[model samples]
Target: MTKPKLSTPAPVIEKVAIANRGEVAVRIVRACQELGLTSLLLHSEADRSSLAYRLADETLCIGPAEVGASYLNIEATIQGALSGGADALHPGFGFLSENADFAEACAQAGLVFVGPSPESLRLFGDKISAKDLVEKAGGPVIPGYQGQDQSLRTLLEKVEEIGYPVMVKAAAGGGGRGLKVIHRMDQAVEAIEAAQREGLSAFGSAQVFLEKYLAEAKHIEVQIFADHLGRVQHLFERECSIQRRHQKIIEEALSPSLSPTLREEITQVAVKIAEQAGYRGAGTIEFLLAPDNQFYFLEMNTRLQVEHPVTEMVLGVDLVKAQLLTAMGRSLNWQEAFHPRGHSIECRIYAEDPYRGGMPSTGVLGFCHWPQGPGRRFEVGFEKGDEITSYYDSMLAKVIVWDENRPRAIEKMKATLRDCVIFGLRTNIPFLLAMMEHPEFLSGQMTTGFVDKYFSRPLKEPSLTRSDRQLAEAVVKTLNREGLGGPRPRGPDGEAGPVPSPWGHSWRSGL
Candidate 1:
């Protein structure tokens, strides 16, 4: 008798080009190292002295400091990858991550784009097309007008039918780029025009559609994966309800409000959207959950997300590794729902002044230290002496923590935020800590408006005690010396200012 055994094929890529910068780029580089794949970091001149530049196997300068000239320059990015001998490219969260033409270009150039095919990218990139497919897949899409009739007259008519307080969104925009919320008929046309202008400038598409904007809804998303073998799986859900200006500031797994039935239904809907589109690779299906528990599919991000670490911490799965495996034509190890091991939370640490209306802070980090513990995972973009530039997103790092339950996780996060030290720029740490202790948040009853309703600065100024006044006087002096007491912090345009290094302070009392 004779027997034969089949050997598994290896993953697809040997070398990967990270076509972005900052924390996400560093995330990709680390994943490549773990998988034994060579990493080529395509960076801008501003990021040349950054941390990811040294960690990757190779680094190539794509263009100057401006994002349009560097990270968003498709031709230069691809050229850098090819010149560096990279066989694949991983577009981290921003920049060209969701650019369909970039995906097509990579395919034509014989390079594997780690996310999805150009078709998938194009389908989901356009809001109109995405709505059509969600309906086809039997997923609930927000009621709106997503027709191809681009005439202003036609749009105005649709807006009238859709009623007031509708959201005008760019057909091919993301990250709140081409979005406008109009609450009256008179504001509809202007809103559409503004959104179209933003769309044209940001995504190179001026097309926009009107959708009914649900007020005070919760933002939730399902982490999903699809392989080359026609199999799809979900890794539970994350509640990203805490946000400001439509951008997520905090994320957590095992949404506290969802019942068992609602969870199953929502996750299935997310899977259906992916299956109907023949989607491959890692992606997220975002939805707006109403107070009554009715969820509507918002959009699908066809790549790894900024809050992916929270999912990883709770589920004990490496999404980047799974992305690599799926890109290599392998199926998920288990084509079913993954059980979460614990509760996890992520706080986006931005270089912004929350007190001064969240103004972006750009300079050198005077001092830097992240929390370290068993369940703490930091995805940092810079080093101790790194420059926190204004050329990109204001987020500088992420602090992800895990525990056996939600309350414990929140407590750990509060302590972690208090212990960390950062200097030379204002941050949102105090704001985040306040959120952790807020009654609504602690009770797991948060909506998208939670921040504005609860965290808005108190109207009346409380009397400061003798010690309080003394401390405030000291802080003002320190801030003035550090150059943070001036007007808005200017970005790196002509002459960049020196980064101030001073002793950092929490500067806030309990709510």
Candidate 2:
């Protein structure tokens, strides 16, 4: 079938309704404003006063905090778009961006989905189907069985054929959910049954597949953009090897471990897969780079990725704008993909206690102080007085840093973390600091299991020496006297406080 042509009819996108909340919603609103599009915001009852809601050109209250009636309720969100007279709907990363039903419904309602086609979503939404496309495109596929008719007996036979220690994954699930590892052939039935049940409950798709599990593999993904005019180009790769429980913690561009030849080969394969899938807009082709340098196709994300900023910083391109232009039927302006210049690092700041198994912490944000300097980008969802609820993901902000080299980027990230402060809830700042200080992390010897192996222990409490405590007390006294209009007091050195004590500016402290 010939692909339908996307025609740019003088920028028909007049207004856009963001069908989500938090940082991603704010990011979309910023993009819409940059393109001279009127930005509309939709919020739940719980998020009536969110920062994004205040920043939008128009705001609509959709439903209650229950996502089923708010974010995930396709009919309500569509009605919101229609009521607001929005020309298009931008489904940010998490809520319903990859939902084929949601995408189709938006199209049927005469509003652009601002993402890939529903056909592409459905095709790549299923792991087995995506694997078939990858194999046809000459991309390396993990040895496994994609057959559906195979019973328990036949599944065992296939497992034996594919060798032991395989992964049983839900065909419809992503984000490390609905996956089980089977070490031997005997465990296949249990693993498959569990995966099927989870997949059905989570994604409403019971289909599952098996693949050979790599022991020591690095998670890498190529960011690709395709316009409706059949123009596709890759913006290099991001090393997401640092993960915990299959969730990324830190992401960087231009992996330190990959050679030039390996990088080119993997990027080419990513483009080939996109061509085979007839993909459009921004998408990421994920892979598992093995210890022997052989990489196998993992899956394709049919929406904007959370780690897209790292790619943008290194390549000096705005992926969000690219998505908008592609959706509007404009071909890419650049004839060639630009080489990634410098190194970029992204740290996901979550409102959770990493020391306590990363349990989600919910409360009002009393204070928030982000670091500001050159090459620092902060993508945040909440502000002071905003509540960090337990209804959604615990991510509070994304701290990204860029530098000319990887080591300098790491140092810059460390400095950024040190300057950040969040109060009223436990955060993962200290946990991220511990990871960055590790010798292995600095040496770039990280893997997917890096967090599991290195960060399993609780972070040590920061120690303060006698002089440090004295200095803290002196600063508190000074702040109380000058800032809060209290009586001035003696300094830590047992002398009257100097007009400008040369101790540098007082560091703001809260969380």
Whole-model lDDT per candidate: 0.84, 0.84
TM-score of 1: 0.87
Residue-level lDDT tens digits of model 2 in 234-306: 9899999888756788999988888999999999999999988888889999999998998999999999999
List per-candidate RMSD values in Å.
7.6, 6.1
Q: Which 10-residue window in model 1 sums to the lowest lDDT?
A: 1-10
Candidate 1 vs. truth: CA RMSD? 7.6
lDDT of 2: 0.84
Model 2 misplaced stretches (Cα beyond 4 Å): 1-11, 149-164, 182-198, 460-511
Where does candidate 1 clash, by residue pair?
12-328
